[model samples]
Target chain A: MNLKSPREQEYIQQLSIDCVIFGYEDEQLKVLIPKLDFTGDFWALPAGFIQQEEDIDEAARRILAERTGLADIYLEQFRVFGTAKRSNKTFMERLVALNPTKLDDWGLDLNTLGWLTRRFVSIGYYALVDIHKVNLQKGNIDASIQWYPIRELPSLIMDHEEMIHIALDTLRLNLDQKLIAYNLLPETFTIKEVQELYEAIYERPFARNNFQKKILDQQVLERLEKKFTGAANKAPYVYRWKRY
Target chain B: MNLKSPREQEYIQQLSIDCVIFGYEDEQLKVLIPKLDFTGDFWALPAGFIQQEEDIDEAARRILAERTGLADIYLEQFRVFGTAKRSNKTFMERLVALNPTKLDDWGLDLNTLGWLTRRFVSIGYYALVDIHKVNLQKGNIDASIQWYPIRELPSLIMDHEEMIHIALDTLRLNLDQKLIAYNLLPETFTIKEVQELYEAIYERPFARNNFQKKILDQQVLERLEKKFTGAANKAPYVYRWKRY
Candidate 1:
């Protein structure tokens, strides 16, 4: 990836945006992590810097669209990562040790990153996209972007891991609203399906009864007719999110 | 009230911190606002800029300590307010129109705020302070710091009002945890007290039955023996947050 052109433009180098776009498929919660290094080792969330004219959220949306070629995704600003120690120095050291190519347009080494060495306080945004839609090749999306299960993420650069964890917690906190907002579930679904989705999201199992009771407590669901089954008493009720 | 000194330091000029410190008194939720104008009218949240060496969170804590003279308060990083149109220009216009003195040490007019006119995206932090504790007169707290009920807030500067609203929403989302975290209530309180606290927080009334059910669902509270003396069933059960 060329880092030279961003400086050529009027990008806000000291502030950046990192997006953790989460998708669910095959009962697994996956996050889109781009391999920023040619060695296929260094990974980071889809990130970009803000331009002088665009808003921070606009920059995040632009970066997401650039990577996935989609829009109107479920996105939320979770938190900002601005520790005193959060600078390019650590990443700078990593790049130097790994010896990645294309340092800059100039012959400057990693240590001489100049103003690039200044601390960048990144604004973290997390998006919940329908996997089938964003992963579709129909859009002007990059074919090289990869998706990895959130739990199985490779070692990420910077504080992205911490960002993901906080994003996950925020997701869990607003799971009901997000599910409703994005139509994450089918129009109607059984308790088992919802439980499976929750399990995929939380990365843990839930007791059937406990799951049922808690889900109902949210009042986001309205019970529909039960699914008729050959086995008596085994038919579970189908429910739809009361999106009112 | 003075903005001249911050520029003299190695402050992160383009990024700032705005705090929405919520305190409860007499069953009313109040927010701290500092009047920034000599006109004694222009109000904004207690805010400051991050230093080059301090962490963002550290900057917020330091600002809180500087204003309240207290530490270890319940603080949270909710969201960052970074829109394209955010700048000191509007505030500058207001200052110029109002004829506020101390325009600048350099006699620069509002039109030439220089880099200060560049969009300053603020990280919004919120704190849940015990009104009595922070309002105490022991620390290096500003004597003129004022607390206004959320409902009766004055006209705010920039996007501080929007910041405060979102902070309150975040507060409601984590009310149970925040309450328990801060020991916001006495060691033991009645269901009515809890409901009142919720009412004060939510700034709305809930049917007694509905509020009780909602509070119980959180499961943060444990019921204690009924206070004897009143007519039998009229006496309510005492409750305490189950810290465990």
Candidate 2:
């Protein structure tokens, strides 16, 4: 898409939105990232410009849906990144070099190029989604879309790494409030699975007995039937989130 | 204060920042608001435009300092308000009617006025300050600056009421983490004072024994000398925040 089109000029120029979509799968935390179409080595969080007529939250939800193909998920605004030099000139120059022909075909003038390369203050939003439910699609500006382990994320473009850091901090803070975790877990999950998820996100091992007691104390989980492994002497009980 | 001047055009036009400075005094939660200079009945959170060369957080701090005449306070970015028609036509007409001569003196043409009255996306930042510490000052664009009890706030302009609501929610969420409250309290305080502060902010009574036990369990407070009441049989102990 030509971001510098005359029609696009009606939108706010110096503001944008970026979403950090967190998903849990295979006993690990993951984040969705898009490979920029032009820069082969550059990855970015699913992000887009805010339309002139939409609310900021609406813009974030629209971007998240467009990229992840999921709606009605748990989404939140975490932080705003507005450093004066966030759009680093070196990164812009590299991007331009990688897509000179594409830029020329877009009919973008020097003024438009300068405008595109200028600093932007982007609002960061984070979404918690069930990994198996996502229908990811590569957009026009992205060569490919994939989920990477949160702890081992590839080098991302601009300040997305910092954005993810802030998002994770926000998630951690909200963890104690019992507002998350359900979004990352399956409808039916073993207590061990729940403990592992917390350990993965918190990057610490919790004592099994203590963790179970603490989580059960919240009174938001419903104990369900035991999962039988045939060979096991005693099957462990599973639980599901009780709707409040 | 002529926003239409050539020098003022160097700043970003579409994005602005507003600060909700919360103060606690006389056992009441208060917020500082400025009476708009032009519109008689209009009150607003201290707000200003973002300079192109500065970071958004820096802009917020500058605005906070400019109005409160204090620095090194606790400030946080809470939310971004970006509705399309945030600048209501009625408010604009009222402002223009109140300041027709001032507008003309600033050489503001109709196009400039229209641009000024167009949609804007503002980042909301909240500051927590000790009421005794702030050197409040009224700016050129404000008829007066005053602190009103949070619950008894006057009608505010634009979406400031919503912003204040979000800020209070943020503060409440952080209260449990024990990361705030110190900003609103004095350096030394009695347990009763601390409980009263919490009660005032939450607008609910907390059981004395349970509140004391919970706060002491955090292990961040150091017991000081007893605070004597003239007719007290046993004086209550004072506590100060321990520097970690």
Candidate 3:
């Protein structure tokens, strides 16, 4: 076999971006994942390929808008997974097993498949959007969309679980700056709900008085005059994020 | 061309790791960069290629030792840069200009050139090492080594300057943890030195009294016996990290 010239190699393959969109509500951590039209019943993170003209960051933002129908929320790049095995033979094997003739069976081109499975150096960005802000959509196939609590996350397509773990670790470490206050609760919530959110994350209950001191000290919440409906005592004053 | 078999098409190229080793000395933040011995003039960060059996993290540790003879220091993966132009045509152009047929002239394997210029996905780990702990070595052919204060870094070889910037940003954001402190000062130092180090990073002097109160309250530092540095004025008391 004649050796391919360096220029002919053309082996620098396509790149894609994967997003692990995180949200918190009802004291449960959640990730916004979607179902693909092509892969019947299979769920995957809302990911998309980078266009030649787009920066990776922009590609992620565009993907978020196209898939979620919500925009202008804050997102942060946490990690980039670039190992050669990122999209290894296992991915192709799984695809082939689903349908041996699926290359043409699905609308996916062979070149597209190669590009899709190319040594994808994925940039993982985790977005903290208010759960209510998410107007989820099924990507070309599924019947309905919903937020799956992270603990019950489905078998993700690739190393997505690892990506979520990384994002959560980053959030936990930077909780003071990137407060869970905005991302995890309802727009208008009672103090009990706020305490529940922290308790869920800390995996234990915090002293009510101490937690109140810490939260109030941040000056990120505004106490409302009205109380939540049907509460037991004094209807604990409702607190809203300073700028939901 | 007939499609290359997947096994044959999958090229396991070389992997290399580089560390943006940072230190603080004399109220300035510095990085340990190498003055290349090959060119005998150009400067670059200390880097070495990964050996076949080593993990990427191990490769970083090995490279650190080869360049600085430093071991068992804290190293954290801050980012990975895999830009198509990280090793742009400039390197090849320089090499080709230096010797029209150097591969043949020096009996070097020309195959190495393809790999050298091809895409490299480098894992960057930033290390905090006490400037005193490093024993610099002329580890590779034609390599000279020196420390460059980050603010005045010389022209670097590739995306290394960007790597340093990201590392510094990571350090700055994690100041509350004081994770980067142990790497900056001696095993024992005065509160003044600690304040000076932070000032160097902050790029402005902090109120001495306030700085002391804030830092000491963190409980990560333990005061030690007075240092007799032979300097005047009531030798300021020394302190060391408690290694919690």
Candidate 4:
């Protein structure tokens, strides 16, 4: 026999999503995060609450498209963060500052308000999109959006900076396996440029001959002719992804 | 300034823990789960509601100990699953079958009984422990505990099965990095044994010479002069992981 009513059950559950967007360009690895319109222009990763009818993955895709104007990009679930203090005082303060009217406008009760502000376990997904493909737009909660080179990111809300660091580490470990698919580069790039991308991520200088030999041995890249660049004595040969 | 009373916050805020317990032995990877006693043997991953005044990780660790007698094992956050449907229909049917007295025992309101089921966004963490180390026990709500190898599993409650499969795939991708630390092997074993383990996971017959070369190149293992069993004459060299 059914003991409880459905309405009470419905009121207790909640769902949300967080996205880690990676972009490779300008010899720097960048992550796309929401720039909060609070406290002299703060920033955080783009995230949102899920609707009753929407799927989590669909929510991620929708949010990515809404904020970046890109569709069909390579996005994958990474890890979930569900700490008790997911939105601690520091985080909610920022949220409140971002939009003063949000709480009252929603007519949220103290309990409902706490549930919204309390421990949230968010599924983290990473999307690798070519930097050129993104035409970034502000989120509903933000007045502006931008891609900051990961190395030079400003202080982020909550533990978002830590989240980005973890995402980058994940990329480094799975680069060989995951590199085959996602389009984080131009249609074609030089060996030097590719190496530079790795360098930016690895944050170290790699031996040139050894690096080239290692990648070439993987048989994952195809070479293309290089056009003269007038300034250089010889144009480096360009290469595009051969297999994913 | 904080707007809500602590009592009001308590009504809204809560914590919980879930475990994906993985075991490997006899050439198969398995997950430990339980059958709900109240729900006519409906299945679920072994989990528990977290108590107040406990850290999130502590809650997971405590649950692991109370359920399985396991302590000090490698546990990593995988992903959280929190869809509204996660706790709908099937869950309550199972719960009603398992706990006829839950509503009365918990002092839950008849009118708001279903709503008390509320939304739970679980933080999923996977623990890799030596199966031998677990002191598995059936809980008050569970009829019995069981281990199902990845290849053979019955219909799971909610998305628990999907969660296990995802964990398994992640484990495979992480095998090389985790070979030494994850207790995927005995303290000492022959190269042939290690090869067999990998072959079992990859589900392919790797070329012996190539496999040996790759293993040697990683410098993760150290060869030993000792050999075991009644066939030492034909046996390969014994090897143990070099401490990381």
Candidate 5:
């Protein structure tokens, strides 16, 4: 089959980017995943191909911004998923075979279908956002994207579930840096709020005193004004992540 | 100029692996780098192409073993360097032009010279090993690999110095987990030895009491038999990384 296709010509054929947008709300951790409507709720991380001259991290940020209109995201390049046969030939090619009209609409022909079967070295970047803050309006983004509680992730497509798990593990491992980097929390948050964030991330409870002592000892947070709840004597102090 | 080359057919073309071997000695941190004889002082990290059927991590381990001959070193995939023009085409092409006889020795032609200029998304893995323990023998490995102190590195080719810097930053950020994963230390070590390792890594001095408290708080180490100096009270307790 001929390799030339004007539609795919603008992209770097061998490289792709996937952005895993993670969210935390109500003491539970979540991830933003898209469900492809044509494939009956087939889910995957929002992915995009890179332009010829673009940097990989810039491509990731572009993809993330296209999917979610949120800006000022701090994206971490977590891992490169580079298995030689990572693309599922049957899933993609069969979809094309089953729906020839869809193929035409997508500007893909029998020859350009090679794009589906060829290898891609995907660079994965993950960003953290507050779940309550994310109000995704799926206007221009073609797929239905939603935040799924990580533990209750629906069936995902083509090793995406594995990617989510790895992203979460990376998120947990580098929680302090990530949380500070993204400013995911309020500027001044109570120790209880910090503890809730930890509980959600770790999916376990921590002893209040030990967790508080550990956070304080890290010296990353500076004590600020007492939390104004109108309880004068019993008010707890709110702190901000010290900017350095 | 046709694409067929029996010499270059076995490997994955789009992906390659570069291993950064770090060493700590005498309160200094060093990196293992190789100098290419063809391009004078053309230093690159020891890199190898991954085979089509090999797993990425397995490929990294294989590359590390082949270069270092050390089997048990733990390799960490730190980052993926994926700029489109990452390959230095003029340098490589000029070298080929200048030395046609050398090209014949390496079994390369114009077609396979495309191999030198093609876009590659390189997966980077960094490993830590004791400087004293690494005795590199240049038997099968083609290049002369040597350890240079992180600060004193010579001119490196094609963004390699940047790679080395990122690898060192990653090494410092993930020091505890990395130190435990590789078993780069002796089976047992003293607090002073641990302090020296930290100083080498951080390139700064840490107060004895604070450093000891921080290490102990991590609780990854288990106290073992005391150093048999026969001084009794003064001899420090040696410890091993606790097996979980």
Candidate 6:
């Protein structure tokens, strides 16, 4: 189905919201990306336009839910991309060329095409979700939805790579003050897992002793029962976020 | 002159930029606001619409320079306010009521009036400037431009009050990491003065010794020759930002 129909043109123009959904598993930081079905090689962050009646935050939440099948996740507005030439004219041209019949089938005329392909100021939002719990949905526009490791991100469409960098920088800056990492973990997990997440984000290994001391000093975690493993001498205790 | 005219209708639609200009003086945190000439009781942050050819950051910088008469100041985009109801209906009504003759005088018809008062998705940028250095300009729309202490801010038009709150929260969050306080200080200042600025921002007092140690440890400051006071045994050492 055509996402941008003539009916949608009545909504706010030239504003869009893109989600940089971050997930962690297998000791790697990952980002959720949607492969464009029409372009075959192009992948983009899950994004959508805001309706006239909806709040921008609500639009972000809707996009997140539509792609990941999750709602009320930890979402933040990090930055705005409002450069005059943010939309790649070459990419749009290629997209148009590749899907001329499809565009006609969807009732998109030259006017609608021009409107759809114009430069947009997108508000970038980042979401943190537990990789294990999310029920990912392959939306109509995407050929497939999958998480790619942050260290080896694929070439993304239209300044999305820069958006990801800004999101990571914001996450790193807020890591301590806000309990953001907790969203990426299970309800209960070992302190070692938490340390690994931090190390992956910062791209540096923390000394075991010092990392434990620093996390404990934050006083935002509660020690829980030990996880038993057959080969372990003394299994490390698990932790749950302490209610403030 | 009507800020919104047929000429301005050619600019980018649905997007605007508002600046929360912060300043420090008299041991207080203050924000720059302009009193609307049309609506006597209404005040707003210095703001403008994004032009078709200008980058959003450049739009922000232009607005800042236009209002404060200072260029190349420390500015950062903090958040975007995109609720559908961000522009208060009551305030717009009052403004229209007070400026009917002016609107007619400037050739603003019903369509232009409706367009001017419609909801906008504003990108919020915050700036820190030396209060002493700003050459405040009372613009055509504003009756007067003045700095109001953050704690005792007058009731502002639209969501500007909330914007100020968010700006302060963002500033406090980045205070330590970015050495943002230096932007609010003069080129040279005493340690005690620095402490007072922090105290004002945080709304609390810091122990003299601990504050001194903390500021000194940042290594961003350079101690200079003491300013002599006739009655003092030893004057506090003046410090300036170290040249990078």
Judging by DockQ, tell me the better candidate of 1 and 2. Answer: 2
Worst ten-residue run, lDDT, model 4 chain A? A1-10
Report lDDT per candidate: 0.73, 0.83, 0.67, 0.68, 0.72, 0.85
lDDT of 3 by residue, B1-244 (tens): 0001112233334334678988887779999887654432456677765443444567678778776788787787787565444553465556456646544555554354555565555668888888887888875443467888878998877777888999888877777674567677888888889888988776788999999999888888888766466767576777898875
Superposed on all Cα atoms, the candidates' RMSDs to the truth, in angstroms, are 5.1, 3.4, 7.7, 7.3, 4.9, 2.7
Rank order by lDDT, top first?
6, 2, 1, 5, 4, 3
Top model by TM-score, which number?
A: 6
Q: Which regions of candidate 4 deviate over 4 angstroms? A: A1-16, A94-117, A180-182, A206-244, B1-18, B38-41, B50-55, B82-85, B94-123, B186-193, B205-244
Report model 2's TM-score to 2 decimal places: 0.90
- TM-scores of chain A across the candidates, in order, are 0.77, 0.90, 0.81, 0.81, 0.86, 0.92
Candidate 5 residue runs with Cα over 4 Å from true position: A1-9, A93-111, A130-143, A178-182, A186-195, A205-244, B1-9, B93-101, B104-111, B130-135, B139-143, B177-182, B209-239, B242-244
- What DockQ does each prediction reach against the true complex? 0.62, 0.70, 0.14, 0.23, 0.40, 0.78
TM-score of each model, in listed order: 0.82, 0.90, 0.69, 0.76, 0.81, 0.93
How many residue pairs clash in each candidate at the backbone level? 0, 0, 3, 12, 0, 0
What is the Å distance of residue A137 in model 1 from its true position? 8.3
Task: Please report, as a residue range, the 10-residue window in candidate 3 chain B with the lowest summed lDDT.
Answer: B1-10
Winner of 2 and 3 under lDDT: 2
Question: In candidate 2, which residue pairs get closer than 3 Å at backbone N, Cα or C atoms, i.e. clash?
Answer: none
- Per-residue accuracy of model 5 over B75-189 as CA lDDT, tens digit each: 7889999776776476677656665676677576656667747666688898877566666844242457777888899787677788888987887788876444224576777
What is the DockQ (computed on Cα atoms) for candidate 4? 0.23
Give the Å error, residue A212, model 2: 3.1
CAPRI rating of model 3: incorrect
lDDT of each residue in A1-244, candidate 4, tens digit only:
0011123333333335678899987888888877765445667688765655555677788878878899787887777665555654566666666657655565643344554555555667788888898898886657577788987897887777778887787878878776633378888888888788888878899999999998889888899866666876566777989863
- Tell me each candidate's i-RMS in Å: 1.3, 1.0, 5.5, 4.2, 2.5, 0.9
Q: Which DockQ value does candidate 2 get? A: 0.70
lDDT of 2 at A73: 83
- Over B10-115, each residue of candidate 2 has an lDDT whose tens digit, in order, gives 7776777889999999999999998877745888889887888898888888889888898688899988888877764567677777777866776765557565
